[model samples]
Target chain A: MSEERIWTAALVVIGDEILSGRTQDRNVAQIALWLNLQGIRLAEVRVVADRTEAIVEAVNALRARNDYLFTTGGIGPTHDDITVDAIAEALGVPVIVHPHARAVLTEYYATRGGLTEARLRMARVPDGAALIENKLSGAPGIRHGNIFIMAGVPHIAAMMLDALSGTLEGGKPLASRTMGCWVAESEVADMLGAAERAFEGVQIGSYPFFRDGRTGANFVIRSTDQTLIDACFAQLAAQLAAAGHDVVDGGI
Target chain B: MSEERIWTAALVVIGDEILSGRTQDRNVAQIALWLNLQGIRLAEVRVVADRTEAIVEAVNALRARNDYLFTTGGIGPTHDDITVDAIAEALGVPVIVHPHARAVLTEYYATRGGLTEARLRMARVPDGAALIENKLSGAPGIRHGNIFIMAGVPHIAAMMLDALSGTLEGGKPLASRTMGCWVAESEVADMLGAAERAFEGVQIGSYPFFRDGRTGANFVIRSTDQTLIDACFAQLAAQLAAAGHDVVDGGI
Candidate 1:
């Protein structure tokens, strides 16, 4: 086994909105992309409802297994926003209004309106938590131990991710290259498998798309080493071209 | 507790593309919506990797708790298509090539390409499983016990869902009404909470959006009873209107 370690993070999407299909979630992709740049792997993601028990269970399970755990949504100023309370329960801690978070909310809401009691709910966090800068909004994110609570909104989550970039301890960042071809993946599955086997440590993912009455797939080669990815991608592209399939460089 | 039972389903999204941030997932929302129409609540969704162990863990954990479990991805004819194998292991059953599935694939591939060994991989399913119709492509979905193994592609999954529509046993379908307003959700948090509290067995979700440099929100009232949703919607609309926030009947 390789001695090199890979840091992994799991995300808990705390919302009834996403579960009910009323809203399409964008946070998963955003967090996944950002985690990759920081040399962290997004290993798992759970979309759980706003229920307290559900949140507590998911948070506890994911945080115990992953190096880091993140939760998006249920941190807003609403009655359904019970992420902090649930997380606190999961961690066996009490919920408290962080002094810094309170001050930030007070200042942000000063010009708009004095922080009402309902709005003040945003200041709550798990006990002994630090604040992650919410460059997009006044309500800062909470980071308790290995768990980071972020906003449900994609842009706000982006800001929180930006604030913590490069701060976490991680191994080599994963690198990937996409090679698309206008042919059915099943037709070339054997060659693709062979290439992947030959390029030890590289993983190739085939994503098929049906567009304009044409069926095609994009094969993604990923590895922690860029050189390995490049070599694998080149071999796959050449194989597809040799098979008389038109190869498209970045995906179709 | 309400006497009416809420049939629940858990989805295990088996894919490396999604976890790698290479593909944006459309399965969760699509399955959630379809399940709602079938009167089954999509209680939770786990996006797991393509690894056999990960798939086995998630499938077993979720299947034991939920009324039905659905999985998407890794049913293709590639080396990474390990969902069927993992699921079979989780069920403690041997994998076998289903006769019906093999016959279907044999006919479908007759015109396209002779059922090559690579293509024959799609016919393999867990023992004692039935096939779900896949209208889009040659391969069919697999079903064993209460678990439904579906295609990762959104449209193909949709076709399988269509074939199984109105076939599952469920109670009343969940109904919802979206009321939008051009005001920060924080501004009306108290009233929204009050409205939700006023209605029994109804839940309200507040979604805030920042669009075109303006802040706004949508309050969604959901319940199994259409009448309950309507009444809650009306009460909330009146409250928001009285508070001087222009309420859009449908979400902005």
Candidate 2:
């Protein structure tokens, strides 16, 4: 497992609405799942307000640490939409009106209304950036190096991810198996620790929940290697069974 | 507004389930909303894995910049739960079995199961830490020098918050007013910017949504001063109306 290549990405969610609790962030989960499907692990997530300095700080810090950096929100056609400007500043590049983006917005708004000055704001991108196609809206996503600037809207971000599917280089996706038992996690803490330590690359997570006046826990075993994951699960399940606990196959 | 003190808090969400996309975080919004009600601003949020180094790093970094730091998750009774240890290490203190916490857990688990050694893990706390009562769960939250360590479960965290409500010092709660208009956010971008600038201490946020086969945007004016927020909302709403746009009072 130490010899295997592992690719990681970080996400920065930028919006005052989210920080104010006015909006619930769906982008983190959406992006994490998408990155997982692309065989990349989502390592960390930061939620910052609609501030230029904050955006720049998060972008620079994360991009330097991870293989890829993704940002969501503040990519709209409003004064608050300053993500492009901040990212451009972070990269030491100038903001430019991407021609393809302008063309797309012009055509899309031709039927609704002529592309007004405010609407044209959507075309702005960091210099020397490639466009990620957006099937839901006219504003295309910006891609420069390993940094991807995406829309704040959940569906729009999903579309951008769809455009990016299978386009990035990554290692094998993580595989996981969940087993549930109606026992306190603490009861099996020793077994869980020993199994995890025995497996080379496996990491086990225990989630406890109280339902219908009963306490239960779900143990999830994850690893890049499917065989290792399976072996770890088998060992854990056997140990739990030996301790008089019934293992639910697919989790409760 | 500039003369008024601004109380800010940051949150560190600790879990592997969240980073794995297996869990959607509810703590950020819940804590943000609760902080707002307490006249404190939620400045930033970071979601990190269940690693001691990551927890320590996030805790040290955010605790220095903000007035208060709240951490959720990684406090359960399992091997994966190591928040107390990590925080204790970060604070350069040894983990001690808090007498109050031990008594509470002992009594709570007396009927279900005797407080075993593994269950007693929940009683460990950083030295010199005070307990924040958890009404839902017997294991209380940890409070040490402006750092509040809460449960991962949303309801239990809410209970902990309820116990500590109004106990912390804070400035005036921010006031906000929302207005909805049946127009693209880009169409009113300039007007929104101007209205925000015209009113002192007011910041406006524009959120666009597509509904009923039409695009609309909601403008929210926020400020510590209610009068200023109202003024900003009135000016922005009038401007939208003057432009032949329908304005909804309470937002779309």
Candidate 3:
């Protein structure tokens, strides 16, 4: 609820494989992380199957509720991939092959000899929607209205995100400072309480993790201001040292 | 969509930790996996913050959409745990401490001699809701209007899920058969296509995994019919073996 920072987004992960628990979807977590750093809160995330009705419902709901809606999956060259038609249906638009998108797909397939009908399936998009650049595969993801449709594959999604980075209008960049020590989360309960009371704008989270057979907790202080973040981290370090816990600087 | 399937469930994960990308929620995946096997399709999965408004919105939406709703998180003895009150708001009911829930909490605290005013916060429940037994700790989860509210902790949620397992009205029990081989996903694409054609009521998914630095793929055939699933797996194995890929015995 900060001024000049009213951006909110939603993620719609479309795939029957994910709902069936056969495939673990990774794009939601990655996209949520990326958006949060830009102070763009991801308000909702829905994972639905490849069914047309389910996809249309999710797309329309998210597009109406969020400032930006991003969808991953169902953009591949398979018969089950029906995101284009579903998205078009949601927007009440016609599904047609965009010339630019077709060009990109043709160029991509031309390298291997020629484009087949199956390969051209990736070129279809909702009419009037602009193409999102895909540096990895060249067959671009399409963006219409508030919805940004990207590939289901993680590597391809990452590449699409990078290509479309500059087009996105970001909010105030959120910052965080991490301080870890050889202490449990419960041990730092009092100091955490104090830190929470001291910082109203920041969200302080304690993560107790066991890694390499060692138990430790990371007290992460997140805020928009770098100075405020640094000040909180210093106080957290001092509190940990006072509590007889080994304090160490945890990198971002 | 099958006939004679009377009930469905949805999961609403209430916590800022998940949205902040600080904690990876395991409950959604666990619930989906268990529910799928029991033939109860998880229609939607939502992750919201500890905020009462967000929780209420999601709880109401999911409750209206699915036959049953399950909520995890915000039941602990902390200020951020506000799921009880939020559920009441969603149902337009007043939240009060139930007699049985209070008795369990009082007895639990009496044993440890650590009962504080803040610790009793877990006893708050919406009116007309029944308590779901929590075997891990005496503090019980609440169920109201087909919404099952449980702890966010993975083990506690699992235990609560088990206790509520008997109460679930199921559909056709979903079965899966996995065939693991050395063939890459692309190499077995044709076999998968054929398997899908051969199995009408089943959903075949391809999972490419890497274990011990060896790349492999797992083709999982899922269906309500056990006979069709077995037959499909047999056909899949035979096709893989015929194509020079070693087929292993992998039953459901």
Candidate 4:
């Protein structure tokens, strides 16, 4: 068997509103799904307040460990939007006005209203960075080194991820299949453990739910190898069937 | 002016489903709102996979730094539910079956089915830990030192928090007021910054939205002192009105 290399990415959600619970975060799920499509695993996520020190610390720590780092929020046109400055400090670089970003903002704002100084703040980027296309808005996302500074807005962040799709190098995507059963998780704990141990590369996650006065669980098996995933699923399903429980394919 | 102490808590979301984008996390927002009502600030959130080493590291780090640490997920009756063991390792203690938990499970499961060994696993807790009431289910939450181990289910976790309400000591709750305006955040960046600076202890967060083909934003001002929060809101509202923008009382 050949060794498989796993590409991992960490997300830093930079916003006070998120930590304060004023805003429900959708970026983590959105970005995680996007990275999975790119064959990159979203390893960890850190949600920090909109403080320069906090952002810098999380960026430095996550970037050092993961292959790529994606940050959402705090990249807006207000005083509270200080993600660029924090990232620049972490990278030991200076913040500068990117000419392309300036041009984009200037042209886009010309029809609406002239770009004021506050609006021009959206054009600032780290000293050495590339612009990620933002088809929805004029202010493009910033890509400095392996760190992608994305908008906090869920829809705009989705657009940024769509623009950068298939650009990163990654290995085979992880494949997953879910099987649901009406048996309580405790009733099949040993069976699930035995299946996981028997499978060489499959990881199973059991999620229990209480619905309609009945308890059920969905067992998700994940593996990079398709044959291994299929084998693991078949074995687990057979075990459940032998135990006199009906296994639901594709989850309940 | 007297010195004000801030009580802080950090949350560790331990689940592979959340990292895999299979589950949208509701614990962060729910716990943050609950902590705010309890007069404790939700300082940071770290989402990690259902790995023992990852859970141990995050639990130790966050619990050491913050006044309290809350962990959600991986407390179920499956092989993947190793949160209790990992936390015990982090605390340098052995996992032991709590008699009270065992009795609770035995009695609760007697009517439905006998508590088997797998079901009894829920009774295990770190050494010298206390049980938090789980009114919904038989398996109680484990409270070891300052660390709180909660269920992965959203509604169950909410019930656990309700059980813990007003139990922890905290200082004054943070007060906040939001003022909305139909102007772009960039248009009032200076005004918002000035207001935050003018108030001795106020934090202003600008959340912008695009609706009806127009740009708008809501400025949320927060402070421990009600008077300071009120002052900051008034100043910010006056500035927005002076700039020829109508200020919405609650939000746009």
Q: Please give the distance, in angstroms, between residue A18's alpha carbon in candidate 3 and its true position after superposition.
A: 2.3
Local accuracy of candidate 4 as per-residue lDDT tens digits, A1-252: 123889999999998899888999999999998999998999999999988999999999999999999999988888899999999999999999999999999998898778999889999999999999998878899999899999999988999999999999887788899999998898999999999999988999999988997889999999998899899999899989998998999999
Per-residue alpha-carbon lDDT of candidate 3 for residues A37-101, written as tens digits (9 for 90 to 100): 66687777888877899889888887897899999987765456689999999999999988888
Residues B1-252, candidate 1: write the lDDT tens digits.
253989999999998889888788999999999999988999999999988999999999999999999999999998889999999999999999988888998999898878989889999999999999987897999889999999999999999999999888887789998988999888999998888889999999999988998889988999988899999998888888898987998899
Candidate ordering by DockQ (highest first): 4, 2, 1, 3
The regions of model 4 sitting more than 4 angstroms off are: A1-3, B1-3
Interface RMSD of each: 0.9, 0.9, 3.7, 0.7
| Clashing pairs in model 1, backbone N/Cα/C closer than 3 A | none
CAPRI quality of model 1: high
Q: Write the per-residue lDDT of candidate 4 for residues B168-225, one digit (tens) a residue.
A: 9777788888988898788788888888889978999999888878888999999989
What fraction of the true Cα-Cα contacts (under 8 Å, chains A to B) does candidate 4 also have? 0.89
**Chain A TM-score of each candidate structure, as shown:** 0.97, 0.98, 0.89, 0.98
TM-score of each: 0.97, 0.97, 0.82, 0.98
lDDT of 3 by residue, B1-252 (tens): 555564678888887777766667788778888787666887777778678898888888889979889998878654456799889998999988788988887887675545555657778899998999987666788988788998887777888888877577778767788888875454456567778887798777665544565547667777878899988888878878888987666722
Question: Over 4 Å off in model 2, which ranges?
Answer: A1-3, B1-3
lDDT of each: 0.91, 0.92, 0.77, 0.92
Candidate 3 positional error at B43, Å: 1.8
Better of 2 and 4 by DockQ: 4
The CA lDDT at A4 in model 4 is: 89
Instruction: Give one digit per residue, the lDDT tens place, for model 1 in A150-192.
Output: 9999999999999999899887889888888888889999999
